[model samples]
Target: MSETRKCMVCGQIFKLRAQCPHQRYCSNRDCQRERKAQWQKLKVKSDPDYRENQRRAQTRWSELHPDYWRRYRDMHQAYKERNREQQRVRNSQSRQVAKMDVSVLDSRLCSGLYVLTHAVCGDVAKIGAWIVHLTVISDLPVESLKIAKR
Candidate 1:
């Protein structure tokens, strides 16, 4: 009978039934998974051959299972929904930024700091705080306003 060992992942006492003498993890599903993941991480860091082998294996698997990702996406509706939600948030943020720029330009035009030129009469008028009220006298169209030369 093997001596009881402390599980490194969960800190639980477990009896070792496996023949491996260096088994530091318990037979619990979560503990075993963590152990395998930790080992793989260390192996990949220290061993270049193992890392290359793993990469090759993944590439080969992907090549053989070309439709695997499609099937996974079809089966996992939550992933698709989450992706769509993130995309919508990104789009809304970009649209808000564009709208802010346009609104700033509109405010500048409405402030009347610029000069307005009459299209029909070819007359120029300074559109200041009180001067905009006299646009009818100058006969200047709204689209005829241009920045005054300082």
Candidate 2:
């Protein structure tokens, strides 16, 4: 009986092929693709000639199909919408705003009670807002104070 080994890519047990002794990845399409991708990544990082060849091939392909992505997006409405939504999420995450309690940079605000409301619908600090953790002790009307919560 042939010896069995675990596939490196998917961690599945696979019988060692008689033809290929050093097969580390499974025969699954995704695993094969991942193996190729890893090999290409290492090749590109280590071999300048391979990197240049890949770049040239990409440039050639781009030249041949200048509007490929535009046509693809037009044809695949769901893909375009999904990409737009993902980009919005990325933009929100990348915005230069704090995700935690606001740092007390300036001592301009008075030492009094305050309320902090969400700048937007959700409590995310990717956008600008004055926030701090607040506890209302007095029966102050809802018309008062800056608050930040962790």
Candidate 3:
């Protein structure tokens, strides 16, 4: 058996394995989380000027390296797509039934006026009913409106 080495992470002594050499943490997740937390703490403690410099350096690097920037963007997009798909699957599994509320329509205008207008127009039959209604009520000409499809 090979000699044991101390883990820099939890400070636990572990036997050297054939797969990994100088392993700081037992698993990849533990190592990644520790590194992320360490960097986050460092960033928090860093001066404003230092953070600005780092941001500028990153921007300059991306500007100077188009290929690197493209690859990084592609990888980020792929990761986002995968994560979104996983979230959609998980959400679809725990589907819930929601009830819609029905309320009575109360209008201050007289019922006779409402009935005459509704009779002249079949329940505001088209998309631009509000505009048309306003035009008709205000004695304005209804212009030929071109409705765009979404």
Query: Considering every candidate listed, which one attains the maximal TM-score?
Result: 2
lDDT of residue 26 for candidate 2: 85
* Number of clashes recorded per candidate: 0, 9, 0
- Model 2: residues with Cα > 4 Å off, grouped in runs: 85-150
The lDDT, on a scale of 0 to 1, for candidate 1 is 0.72
lDDT of 1 at 60: 99
Instruction: Please write out the lDDT profile of model 3 over residues 31-140, one tens digit for every residue.
Output: 65896787767985777776788789989998898698457757799877887899999788644322134223337432222112323445333443331232123222
Q: Who is ahead in TM-score, 1 or 2?
A: 2
lDDT at position 101, candidate 3:
42
Candidate 1 error regions (>4 Å): 16-22, 88-150
For model 1 the local lDDT of residue 42 reads: 100
lDDT for 31 in candidate 2 is 92
What is the C-alpha local distance difference test score of each model?
A: 0.72, 0.79, 0.58
Q: What is the Cα-based TM-score of model 3?
A: 0.32
Ordered list by TM-score, greatest first:
2, 1, 3
Tens digits of lDDT, candidate 1, 1-150: 768889999999988776787789988999999999999999999999999999999999999999998899899999988988999999986754323213233432333333445344323232321212223333355356664679
- My TM-score estimates for the predictions, one after another, are 0.52, 0.53, 0.32
